[model samples]
Target: MAEEPAAPTGARSPSTRGTRRRGSARHRSYLRPEQPSGSPATSRAARRSARAGRRRRYAMEALAAFAGLLALVAFVGWWSEPARQEPPQPGGLPAVVGRPSLPGPVPTALAVPGLRPRERPPSPSPSAGPPSPAPVAVPTTLTVSQADIPDTVHLTETGRRDWMHWGLGGAGGTVRKRDGTGELRDLGGRGDRSGWDGNQELFRWRDGAPVKSVEATAEGVYVCGTGNGFQLAVAADGQPRTATVYLGVWMARGRLDLRSSDGGPSRTVRLEERHTSRSAQVTIRFQAPEGTRLLLSWTVEETFTPHCGNVGLQAVALR
Candidate 1:
């Protein structure tokens, strides 16, 4: 009766009809996905796609973290280390104090096998100096006489003439004969006797032939000839202030030169045509210094053809 009264005005009875509808709707909504349901294969494909997306997001996050770590390490390294600096060069001003100086690169020593060791340079000797000059042996007094002349003269007789051959003596003197027949001849105008003629001439022997005649003088076992030069070295007994040379000449037309080892000045005497006929004499005077050797030399130049003359050193006196 009460229910009949209540249902009288637009009120439905609480029945299972509305309950089933709401419950089914809620069940359908709960069971249905937001996206439409596809086939089984499509569903599996969608699930695989979701898994792949999740993996990609995780990979990106890991990569970002790794990049941040690398940045942090680089920053720390840059801050902890010192700034690089160039090394100072030599011959320049020194680096400022309290500033760190970079060390220079060390030089490497190279080693080679089978190589010889380097030789050390010779050290200078402290006691080394220029050597002293050698002392020259000077005679206290010396005399040159005809007896001191070496007996090395040669004479050969050939019927009408005689030949005199004399070599350069051991005193290191030279004799050169030119353009003459070097023979002692008898000057008897024409057809004269041979052995020791009072008038004899000297000739130059050249090419095994008698070429020209030379003037000669026979004086004291010595035959001095023209065009025959001689250099004689004589000793001095003492340091003489002056020297006088006596020359024995016949028909002289030559020159006499005097020199000394003491470096004294040289003197020359020339004989002209005035003393050409017979025996003549010449004197050469020169200053002689102490501790000096004397050298006497005679030279004859053939200015005129058949120039007849002979010269010899008779004596040399030093005082």
Candidate 2:
């Protein structure tokens, strides 16, 4: 018998294929996420599972991207921040967390060291401008006066640059200050002198040269007649100094002249006793630059008697 050919499985007969399929057949299976349209039918659960898996994968990818973005942001902030280091401390003190280091101090201007010594001050030339004014006040000043001899002349033993006691030996003999600065000087005299041990007033000293201590002494040197005297000087050291001259006149007139070497004021004092012996003191105060001097002259101005009328110098205390 010529029977009709059997239709293949999953395929409809020619007459049934012409129109749309009925019932469950009309509902085709949902597409897989990776499959194209019109593919063979697959299980619904399998397609649904594939779609859910795709969704979960996409979510995971998004979450990973967000995590990467957060990491990048943290890196940028860390790079922009400043680096800090705290000094190490002993005894296990806690370190400061976020304190930044401070900058060093800045210099105001650049300068060369040790340039002042060779620099010379500007001054006007003699012809360029009127002469500069003389110093308003001299660096040194001096004053001299005569007075009656005091009964007790207190000798300054300490606190002196130098001290001297002259005529302690004899004529052409002298004594200087011990451990002194060598400032008191005898610059020689104008005439001959003789030793005399008959002076009225006596000198007492606790500090001496060779003779460290002496209660009282009345030995001296004398120069007779006018135009003859003792010339002395004291070196200046920028400090006030005093030279006390204990002198006597036997029937003679004495003149004391004192001046500063630096053009300071000069003073002269005179004392006279025509017939009897008279004693006096000449105190001189002066100041000058170091290495300069205070010039002093003690002379006999006139004589009452021609035999031995003279100026007698007992002792000189320089303190």
Candidate 3:
């Protein structure tokens, strides 16, 4: 090359340095990432604004879609609603409206094996009824009479209902019928009574109370003076019954009075023995209503002697 003019003292040597200029080059470092254009706080605010805008847009879109779905459901229901109908009147018969629903099946009773089937009886008519029961006839007859003393006086239980005997253990003691009906009662008397074993007629019994058994005995009780005697009663069951009272009089007139405790007919009989002891059996057959009593009262109507002439009682039997 034409001898290159001698390079100035400040120029590069030709072997290593080029006379033409080289293209410009630039280099970046991976160790440090590049930051955005603005300051750190400003860049973060811008990113947040962008994200919030996107989120709001998405939420609006979702809300709008939900509102549209509700509107669609309402519209569908309103348009497809069923029409109104009148209720079926109860008075309308099947011929007029046809049966709205089929009748329910009736229950049928089935016969059990080896068993008989019984049909219900028909109801009774109002116009007719079973014949009324015949009116019961009540026994209303009462009779009082005197009778002779038999040869043998059965003083025991004697297959009768009840019996009461006085003076069995002397006076001031009594014996009731054992296991009897408890229909006979001694109601006490108005006067003083005493024990006497002088009665001629014999008394015997095997069944009694307080005194279980007794042999032949002539013991009795007596009340002295006029208008003083003994009282007795037998319960009435609206049936006929008989009662025999063993009584006696010594030198006095004795009176036997009878009546129904509930108030009815009354009868009287008299026995007089002014000189000696006289005995008799009064048979009284009476009938009265239930809850009545056959009352017997023996009183000394008159006295033959001034010294304690009295009416005597031995025993009473019932049937």
> Local distance difference test, per candidate?
0.42, 0.74, 0.80
Residue by residue across 1-319, what tens digits does model 2's lDDT show?
Answer: 9999786788877667655554335455433245645565556667888999999999999999999899778656744565465665588877665443343387433433532212223444457667788654438788877788776554544226665555777786665566777887888787888897777766676666677777777778888878788888888887788878778888999988888787778888888999988898888888888778888888989999979788877666666
Ranking by TM-score: 3, 2, 1
Name the best candidate (by lDDT). Answer: 3
* lDDT of residue 146 for candidate 1: 24
lDDT, residue 289, model 2: 82
Backbone collision count in every prediction? 13, 0, 0
Ten residues in sequence with the least summed lDDT for candidate 2 = 111-120
Candidate 1 local lDDT, residue 219: 24
Per residue, candidate 3 scores C-alpha lDDT tens digits across 125-232 of 567678899767665667777776665566774428999888876798788778988888899998988998898888777787878777777888999998999999
Query: With candidate 3 superimposed using the best TM-score fit, by how many Å does residue 42's alpha carbon deviate from the native?
Result: 75
Residue 196, candidate 3: Cα error in Å is: 0.7
Residue 282 deviation, candidate 2, in Å?
1.4
